[model samples]
Target: MGSMEEPSPETNYTKPLGIRFIEYIKRSNISYKTHQVIVLIVTFIAYASYHAARKTTSVVKSTLDPASDEVSLNSLPWRRRPFSWILGDGWAPFDGSDGTVLLGEIDVAFLAVYAIGMYFSGHLGDRINLRIFLTIGMVGTGVFTSLFGIGYWGSIHSFYYYLAVQMLAGLFQSTGWPSVVAVVGNWFGKKKRGLIMGIWNAHTSVGNITGSLVASALLQYGWGWSFVVPGLMIATIGLVVFLFLPVTPESVGVSEEDESDSPKKSGAEVTSPLLISSRAEVKDQPVGFIEAWKIPGVAPFALCLFFSKLVAYTFLYWLPFYISHTAIDGQYLSDAAAGNLSTLFDVGGVLGGILAGHISDRLDARAITAASFMYCAIPALFFYRSYGSISLTANVILMFITGMFVNGPYALITTAVSADLGTHSSLRGNSRALATVTAIIDGTGSVGAAIGPLLTGYISAKSWSAVFTMLMGAALIAGLLLTRLVVAEVTAKIEESRSRRGSTSRSQPAVIDV
Candidate 1:
């Protein structure tokens, strides 16, 4: 009765859902841990949003006619049949110099920039604010992505217009992985990293699935709208990331003293003057960028990623076109039907990513997981080509399996592998090197991402048979690169044992697999 007029706890509960959530979070386990987990989930959604934006363009290609250089509404393939996609009137089914070429150019533009940008993006994330950097990237990507759709609505028939947008989007999009990988590497420890990264990687599949569904829905209105809708969605999610993403565990409440004690970093340095309550103490101050050539196995990893992406993206950028080419009863189907059927690959792709991540987590052998996918892709691609000729049903089944194996490595490498390398023990026990490591891996992969479509585009221009062969070859090459990783692992283990027995001493530390 003599207490001052203080508001009751119930009075504070009137805040909005998000505020309430924040407050509720504050009361739970150290805010630092809960905040990061929450932020991570949102970041995952943001990544998914990027895919949603990306998928829209591919799905709508079935309706748009870029081949004839016509954005004319009258020329739009509105008939809504199984496979009547016009792809901007670039080329007829299986015709050289058609949509395949144009799609390839678009892919090359994006991949080239993405690969190059990723190198710098990772280094930059280490020095700059990761959350801010990621936000900017997401926003820029959203703008360019949305512009692709708006161009169609404005009767912009210029293929270059779309190509420009692809380049910009690709550049900005590369920022996401490095930043996320760096942050995640900081949040989690070496223990169970493979499994955690694997589960986290499922976001890729989820994003692809969401992108497909959203794009398909918007394509019903018009192909351009598909781009516009997903673009807006990505932009919105990016804004959310900017607001909610926690850069490190310290922000919410994880004591730096505790984290500093972990083997990844040093406990004695927890109270260093460089440390702060509000910010993360990046392990290596003023980190220098390492050229791809300097990192051991980086070159091979890049080559591997390139080939893997070549096959993976060939499925991503051209599956609709491939499906459109499928002969039904020895007759070519329409574009709409073909485009719809191609989505089965994406559907299966989701499962493949999740399954691959789960399995790799258990095996703890990243090399074998990727190599297995590479090997499986060979037979799957063979059956895909042969079965497509037999019946549409066969084509659908084969495409799904093909996509599953093709994309499995894609998820493994980009997510799990990057995390593994970024957290590799060779960093002189510096976790801050994560951004640099991520950049190196992704930058190398970008080479493959760029080449995959260009190769497919060239092959499609020559013969569809050639395209399948190229994809198969890329898969084989990727598998071979992973073989090198396995070899390196064995070599390192032997070195470790010899050093313990004083048989051999290593001056240059070995890159420990996390």
Candidate 2:
């Protein structure tokens, strides 16, 4: 087996200070189990911080364009609109009548670039050291996130400035999901990946919740602080990730003996026939984009996720605005209150992700689990849109349910499903495909993510009902996309069950007669 010391002299020279620190730690008497735990915690916090920063824009949107019926800036005795602002009302271009559409455009700019960048970043992640790739992404994301906030204090209202910053931030954000998923997949195998990743995936909702609370809390001070604080947070966590993240077992000199003993505790079955054979001979070549797309389940799951993300991200970016604009029991919520309330959706999402993962693992059927979630989300969306305005309790309950169903398949596909496809048997244990496959699936989904928010902006001006209809239709389509795969899994499961029963009968009858 090759040792960590086998890298070229140039590669060693270019190693970050964090990699050196990790090497120093590895010299100590640490167990493989300890290293596994650290990987989980560090990656969790790192990605969560990324989401937290991404979420700031959504929470602060209402403050950028306060509703006309609400108390105006002029009504406040202590506060006055700044003279440098283009409009004496709210923030310039964004505060205008076309503000919602502009907001949607900004979302499209960010997510469109994000979707495009994902393809390249995935390829890069497979070739380069993941720790370095991930750290650079987080830091870049922080810088751009803060730059968006800096525009407020600088009295700069150029629409292009915000648009450009968002575009850059999206590019950086594209690095996060693929890198982290690849790292986790490196450490774990397919034994119970769905359930394990499902619980781990809570980081997404947790980050959203944290971002909403933090941004909402700071809205009273200034909208800029909302972005600045989260920006600083992700940047800080990036430093921590650079310091301690181990890219793979081989990188830390974990012995073969340690790996053999570690899977039981780690929930990874490292001894699986495929993995065992693959690890026997190291393949330096990574899978190409065209090759990854050719993998059997990859294309269908990717398409399903496209529609799935459309529904989920629409709510992610615009739900707070919707909550604040629409009345609940004849009362409209303040920006902060609405932002805070929007977190219930993510709260339900956390649970839904875990439940979906557990069900998929138990059934050993990823497509069936994902498709069912999408089917349920249709009714959930309808109920929330129709009855959510009736009362606060009803709104919360319906919204939570809607979030659960909408995010369930999304969570399953992005994490467990992507990992599974990346490590499919046809690859013959070529683990290098993990990042590229993950990128293809998620990159395709991001296109829909961009479209969802962009369309919501235009459609919302007409009627919120139309928006609900679009979401429900998307959810239905998402389920339909998975039908073929779901049927295959069902048929395979039936055959396996019959084989097991036949084996049990054959093994028991002869001995009983004797």
* Leading candidate by TM-score: 2
- Put down candidate 2 lDDT per residue, 1-514, tens digits, no spaces: 3233444465445444565665555654345676678889989999999889988886566566544223221111112222224323567667888775566568778888999999999999988989989999999999999999998899888888999999999999999999999988887777788888999999987797788679867767777888999999999899898887877766765543664647755777657888655675645678899999999999999999999999998887678778888899999877557767887998888889999999999988999999999999999999898899999999999999999999999999999999999889888778888889999999999999878877876798899999999999999999999999989998999999999999999888564554
Task: Report the C-alpha lDDT of model 1 over 128-150, residue by residue, as the tens digit.
Answer: 87877888988898899889878
Root-mean-square deviation of candidate 1: 8.6
Which regions in candidate 2 have their CA more than 4 angstroms from the true location? Answer: 1-27, 62-101, 217-223, 255-282, 324-337, 389-391, 510-514
Q: Over 4 Å off in model 1, which ranges?
A: 1-21, 24-33, 60-107, 149-166, 215-224, 255-282, 291-293, 328-334, 391-397, 490-514
Worst 10 contiguous positions by lDDT, candidate 2: 71-80
Model 2: lDDT equals 0.83
